[model samples]
Target: MDHKAKHILIVGGGYVGLYTGLRLQRALRRELKSGSVRITVIDPQSYMTYQPFLPEAAAGNLSPRHVVTPLRRVLSKVRIRNGKVTKVHHANRSVTFEPNAGPSEEIEYDVIVMAAGSISRTLPIPGLADAAIGFKSVGEAIALRNRVLALLDRADSTDDEEVRRRALTFVVVGAGFAGVEALAELEDMARDAVKYYDRLSEKDLRWVLVEASDRILPEVGPEMGRWTLEELRERGIEVKMKTLLKSCEGGHVVLSDGDAFESATIVWTAGVKPSPVVNAGDLPLDERGRIMTTTKLTVSGTNGAFAAGDVAGVPDVTNPGQYCAPNAQHAVRQAKVLADNIVRHLQDRPLREYRHKYAGSVAGLGLHKGVANVYGVKLHGLPAWFMHRTYHLSRVPTVNRKVRVVADWTLALFFKRETVSLGEIESPRDDFRAAAATG
Candidate 1:
């Protein structure tokens, strides 16, 4: 093989991008050091969020800072570009890169990996874009925590019945794992927080969950899903099945089932679609807008190009006629195979096919409450909750982050969860601007 220098560009710094870059830097250390190979990772943010911990971060079970791993620190050997890939001209072996500031430029690469993950899937429900918040990133999680606590404060300070009722009512849309865990965790936090307020109690708060489908947590199978539904209902949470949010204009929520109410807090965790960046390239894509890839993790019909994780429709060889589910389990495992295949391709060696059997799912409902179906064994309540924490803790990226998360969890055991609102952080210049106007 020629010893000419080669540049490998990885788009998006999420699970696949980070892990693949980390592995490539390690696997090709000599080549990298000798200037024979180079790797660059680009994303809007400089860190990779450990998404499974987002709910816990919102609930104060984990620190927000610990929920993300800095890409630069993790991929030290690779170049990190904190920006966006506006367009990919694969036919010309280059992409249009837009940095956080300044003009956009085109970057040429010998090989490209499309790991730009998915975004929150939303609908055209009335007032959704303005009134509802998503539960995807760390910023959203922190903002949600602050919003809930702020609303609680408002409810306690006011004597108006209608205002208090609106402030205390919380509505969460969708019933998937993200929705269930978020609702459960936030409810637990709010219930504990009410103890500190003289005029507020658990009874004053109303938590409602709406699902267009008949069941929630469908990933855990029907039996476990039923158990979760009953558990939420027993806790005084209104679980509306086969119902849709027809409108939520200006905090007034209307349902498809003809129910209407006023709520100050509305959370949307319905679903996710492939990142729009996938559409900016001439790559072969499936009907669902995901980049198409073979079992070996290489982009279909494209040389020196690859894709994995939520953005790629990787065929599941273990299950005939099915593509791998877009989840952390598949994404993490696929990263390993993707990195190896890239190296194998470089060395002119036969690439290994990516295949992994489906493992069961685990989700934390709240503190000491969860459900799990690993392999064929099923668990519920406390045992499953322990498994949920244990499994995710083991998967968190770095030793530094893992230790910090464990420390946060350890402190929570002996102390009460913090319930303070820092909503002002979202708009830090507001107070300064007000002072300037007064002067």
Candidate 2:
């Protein structure tokens, strides 16, 4: 391979792709300036979302725009392409991407970094595709917030008992961090929003949390998880354990535990699987369809091809016989190691193994309420809530975004959360198109 000018193609622009490109832009600064190497990042979106803040965004505590970082602005030296890689011909050292407004194009590279991340893991539940919404992106978070507030408006304006009950009941499936936090935050928001309605009381709103697993928040340990369940139940939120969402047709939800309910909002946060990019080419994938990578973050038995983050099944060096769990904490740290290893590989230097200990987790139940188990220390209530804010604020990516998020929080201290829902934003051209057709 010629060492004159190398092209490093980074696929996906989420946690792994964006962070890896940022680190590479700095580590290869001299090489980039001297025209010895060039980096290109490709993704469908122009920005990388900080997913940890999705729940707060949904609950109206944070602005939706502030939780995401623009990639082109963050990595100025690295070329940015807003498109989707439809195919990867690794052996030919080339990839095909379909641009947003142009025909599909192909580009060849000297090195490839596959960090396409994951998508919402869905099931074949009846009416799921049409009735349920997945909680993954900032758009979904904002849409959910709007939907929740819109439901409140619907309930307050309605006179029929059935219509009001259906509009006020909210259902959330899954018991992981995403589902738990989303449910807790929205429940708190709804309870607060009710205070402004003369006809609606807290009892008028029904919140249901259905989990297929035996317990919720498995990441925070059994003790904390149990306590969280009790707390939510104390707030009148139904905690249905060992239950499954059998069907949700026309806003009628049927659960496995012989319970039936009507709800206008259903949020699905079951889990995530590797992105479709995992099968973009003939890459070796594990049972879960993740690209198989060695502990060094290199594709097994392949040269000049590497992968990390949720899309790659990277063996955990800290754990004897397990692969790293797909999470932001792992993805952020893995990118640094992955970028360093890629640079070492280019420079013909010995690569170092990636390893890190689990640092534990923190979760916010609602405003000024949380639970955290960090490094064997467990905390709850106000202290845990403050820690959750502090930790994520520090890791929100880019100084500007961090500042904006803090400003939002600081402003929240003096003001109330905005409860107005602009559902028309989703269909801005509806009235215009209707009038034009009638004319």
Candidate 3:
């Protein structure tokens, strides 16, 4: 193989893209030194968010910026492109992309890595696209923290009882990890925030969690899942099982079980589908629109093309006849092996297959409350909450972020979590625009 310059293009800047680029940067030392290899990372966002910390961040337990790692700062050697890949032609090793603010252009590469992550899989319920908020991004988490506190303020100031009731009632759909943790954290924050308002007592506020499945946290096993359900119910959270959100038109929430109520806030955390990137490319995709890959992490039946993480349906060696589950743990581990395989391919060496045994799951249910099932050992309450924090603390991207997260927790030990909501952050320029128009 000629040692001429070889360009490798990575699509998406999420967990898989970021980790794979970083690994390549480390592994291709000689190639990089000789200027024989060039790596470019493309994504809509310039930063990678640590998704597990989003719940804590939403609860004001951590700063929003601390949860995101800037791609340029971390991937120094790799070129960072802030854009979306509009189309991929793997047969020709070329991609057409549109930058954040520019015309679409095409680029050819020697190798292509598809790391486009998933997005919220939503139903076409009435008023959902306009009213309900998703719990996936940093913006959503920060907005939620502000919105939750603002709801309390609205309830306390309203004279109409119906208005107060609507403002105080919060509905969360989906009971998976994202849904459960988000509901728990916000519930905890609201419980703590209400104490300051004399007009808003604990009884005045209502929290509802709706799950389509028979139970929540299926990864934690039925025993722990039931325990979590009971624990959530014991905290006065209305856990509606085997129910679906019919609609949230104008904050009037309707459920599948013939229940209807008025809620000012409805958080959607149900599930995610493969990002549209899979559809943008010509690669072979599963019925669900996920790129199909072999156990070795290469795009099925294609050379010089690879994929991993939420967007790729990589055959699961441990489970057999099934693909790997989409989660941070799997994405991270798969990225390491994917990076190694890419380097091996370039070096004309054999690639290693990727396999991982399930390590169990952990979840935080409000302060000092959680559930975990590690290696078949089920734990509940404070111990599980501690494990939830400890495990994620270790996995969070950089050391700087880890320290900031720990500091947030340490300060919480002494000082209270800041409940003040500058909801104006959402529309900081609104006042200025109004003033300018009046002037």
Candidate 4:
């Protein structure tokens, strides 16, 4: 609060923003408590979600609440603001935030960290926006979880094959880490859900994976992609590659590969683009609309301004051919350097640069099935799946959340996944109407 205190304002509460804020608090514990420095984190969401666990959350393997780390409770030293930044006048060293339930408020800062992160990168496919749902965000994940369970319920009560097929047919477009893992996990669960319904059978349901490229899971290389295709095909899951979504109006998936399927569930996880917030203020953006930053994590042409993670187009000094891809792998590594350079700026020390090798990618395909490549070491089957859980559990923020997550896994070892779909929570209106009518 003091005039001389260096105020560090972080513009997001995601992988980079949350980690950086917490790191700063730990590193400057004495300074922050003494009011020598003030840290502020501005984000619309009150929590930072562990995105790698999203598939499990959607598949009922993990609770949504458990995966998200509350910003205030964890980063107790930082002042948390719940609002969207409508305008960022970085030139004036101030930003305007539009509260969720109130008018906009402005705050000034000595240093700003642009970590607004990426949004669901959508395409212009016809009727896709209305017909297809994205697989990001806690809301979207919970909604998809409900939709999946509800589809099973609808199928159980109906005798019509037409309706049954539509309800059971789940189409996932895009075979990236998100799309592939989602389809694999959800299908595994749906197949399990049908066991409780006498009317529904595993064979009756159809799962389709439509990818724009010839290979799925492009991050693990073509051979691994081919291996995944074979695995999917063996599971009786339709794997259509090099196909484009021509139209998906009314849940009818029309593809370029001469296939048209009727489905009630359509998930779009094709790609992601930087959020519009990158261009919201006066921040410099690259062609992809990502905030452009130097190797030292400093925003180009700005002294106290820096950025990293998905929203930042941080130069990939390790790879000359491209910038760092938008993934947690790069984001976490970037946060370490970003935090160091920020301290460097404070003490007039030379700023350290961010240079990380893409340590390969990992994907979980439900239980006992996964694909991973680390430092050119390829792993699959149960080993990859176990490694996947171990890696993420270790990376998930905070000791409290880590213990709970590990307990969730330990219990999973003794019992099957929870089938109870808290689907009603997705739409409280149903219960509200029931209560009103009963009253």
Candidate 5:
């Protein structure tokens, strides 16, 4: 690390932190003098995942690598550390990091930006934390893809009808964008994969979407949500609205509404809560557990301490009734302001508040179909779907990732999306062991 320069330590290399550091590098370079600054970004993963493309990655429409922006590559001027941040010392302006191998380290900073983002919000449902998978990062997306394809292989190879049926039955526990699109994309992929399996047919598989709400995609209004329900059901996906998964025991799911089913895939995208880091040191947080912040984006009761993204409950100015919902668009913009504020603070300048309106929600519903609500216009089916992909591909972090993503889509236009499940990627040596043992 460059000890001679002033350091701006940023926590969480997710949407906000990554983008904040990216802007800080450029802003600080133009905004600061030589030996004036060094921005250090610390997070467990070294890449920022473009979450919107995860459904496509799960469906094999975009290559997994194309959706991720490597922090080191993108933020060359910033020091990148791959580790978990344990504590923030506001008084001393230092942060404690627990590296994978080295003794716990502490780095003093002139300013700190809290952009740790959020984690998968899980309920206390039995067997969920252990058995259910999360839909937050690249690993889970890749894992879900692998599992979907593996289910087909397992169905094809198995002689037991019960086992095959269970293998083909997929349960996604949230009807939000992540849950809906993941289930939709994978279901489309799995259904196509049936052609390669002798025993497996589209009829043999089941995709169940369980939501506790009265309707799905609240951002898109009830009508569109109902239309989505019809569209999914028409495609053979069981949209179980007004219900939820009560438990997951021995790969069997118990729904809250007195129903049960056996399935190999259980994905939890119910929503997200603030990272415990926001309140880990007993920081001031709103009742909902998010760090309280002003529209200008500073922690409500603290000076020199800033929080944004999934953690900061910045009041939504446009909608008087609520706080800004934690989404990628807000996170990306807030990071820019947060970085600017930090730069101004360093120069003893005035800080600016954050303000933005909801641009509405966009969702990919597998293949050429999608759903979106921008400004008051609600859309469903193919047109919405095209807009969904177009919008996300445009904002996916970097030109490198953007080009690769566009190429992936362009190539996919000519080729049918790869429905072939590489589930064996989860356990690569399974095939070799069976043949060698039998031989």
Candidate 6:
């Protein structure tokens, strides 16, 4: 057996990348220690965010720091590079890496794992890039939390009715898990926060959810989706289904239904497409720009190349003629198979195919409110909400993060939700710059 050293390069540090690296480091511990196997993970961010908790973090139900795990700490045995893969030249077994600073360089590898995940799929709507925010990253979540609270403060301090009204209206686009949960959780937080304000009440706040599709939470089936819609509407949230956001020019929302309103906050969570980095490679891609992979998680017609998670179109053998849904459930499970296969490939052993049954879906609407359909059993309201938190808590990666998140929730039971906005953190240098100028 040739024990020559081999370098494996993972393209993204998201769910798939982090988990695969973790598994490989542990499984190939001897090889890694002996310098026979080298693994390098390249990502723009140093931490992998538990995206399921982004809504809770934004709602002040959980701390933003607790929702992310540092890649260095978790993948201690693997080399971590804080950079983005600008291009993947799989034909040459190298990729172009662009660091946070300086020039781009090419990184060669023996095995390349295209775990680069998806990004928010947005339209070219007018003023969208400037007026709207995405709910993808931890930074975006924290910024949004501050933005919502700061808007509340602005509305309270303003004398003009128009300004107050605009500041009070919040619009969330999309009705999927991200959009719905963010809207519900933030609305709950704002409703609770209004009690502390002298002039503001829950009645003054307008929460609108715009969905181009007729149904929301379609993953949970139509019955549960309809139930969620009713529950949100019962809470005074206007659910505009089958309606499109025509434009949000200058914070003024123009809907396809001919309704117009002013909202200071517009959240976009409609959909996500494969990362553009995939296209820069010579690998074969599907029509949707996702890397085409077999049931075994290996890149189609390519050796020493694998892909999983949102970036890969992995065939679901369990559900014939369909690809696995790009979700955390599939990503986490696929990582285990991918890591094992990499080891198997290295050892000249047969690789195992990746297959898993769909475990339904659970979504938290707000505190004590949720909907779930697990293995044909349906649950709603408090039970579903509890399941939502419990499931995500169990899946949040490290024990440290799980413990911290639990502590936050435990404290929330005794204390009121934090409503203070730390918008200044976004630009910490602003105050110092002003003071220096005066001096």
Q: Please report the candidate that would top lDDT against the real structure.
A: 6
Task: Tell me the tens digit of each residue's lDDT in model 4 across 1-439.
Answer: 6798999999999999999998888888998988999999999989999999999888877878889999999999999998888777989999988878887888898899988888888888888999999988878887888888888898888888899889889999999999999999998888888898887788988899988887899898877778878888888999988899999998888999789879998999999888778877898888878887899999998878999998898888888858988899888888888988888899899998888888887789987899888788888888888889988998999999988887877787798877666777766799789999999
The reply for model 2, stretches above 4 Å from the true place, is 1-4
Candidate 1 ranges beyond 4 A from true positions: 1-3
Instruction: List, residue by residue over 1-439, the lDDT tens digit for candidate 6.
Output: 2356799999999999999999999999998988988999999999999999999999999988999999999999999999899888888989999998889998889999999899999999998999999999999999999999999999999899999999999999999989999999999999988898999998999999999998999999999999999999999999999999999999999999999999999999999999999888799999888999989999999999999999999999999989999999999999999999999999989999998999999998889999999999999999999999999999999899999999999999999888999999999999999999999
Which digits, one per residue and each the tens of the lDDT, describe model 5 over residues 299-412?
777667788899888988888869888888899889888888888887889998787888888888888888888888988889999889888877888888888988998998
- Candidate 5 residue pairs that clash: 149-421, 296-353, 370-385
Error of 2 at 287 (Å): 1.8
What local lDDT does model 1 show for residue 209? 99
lDDT of 3 by residue, 227-319 (tens): 999998988999999999999999999999999999999999999998887898789998878998989899999999999999999888999
Instruction: lDDT for model 2, please.
Output: 0.91
- The stretch of ten residues in a row with the least summed lDDT in candidate 5 is 30-39
- Give RMSD to native, each candidate: 1.4, 1.5, 1.5, 1.4, 2.3, 1.5
User: CA lDDT, every prediction?
Assistant: 0.93, 0.91, 0.92, 0.87, 0.84, 0.94
Q: Number of clashes in model 5?
A: 3
Tens digits of per-residue lDDT, candidate 1, 1-439, equal 2446898999989999988998898999999988999899999999999999999999988989999999998999989998899899999999999999989999999889999999999999999999999998999999999999999999999999999999999999999988999999999999989999999999999999999999999989999999999999999999999999999999999999999999999999999999999999899999988999999999999999999999999999999999999999999899999999999898899999999998989999989999998998899999999999999998899899989998999999999888889999999999999999999
- For candidate 2, report its TM-score: 0.98
What lDDT is obtained when candidate 1 is compared to the true structure?
0.93
Which residue window of length 10 is worst by lDDT in model 1? 1-10
Clash pairs, candidate 6, are none
Q: Which stretches of candidate 4 lie over 4 Å from their true place?
A: 434-439
User: What digit string (tens of lDDT, one per residue) describes model 2 on residues 202-299?
Assistant: 99889999999899898888888998988899999998999999999887899999999888899989889989978879678988789989999999
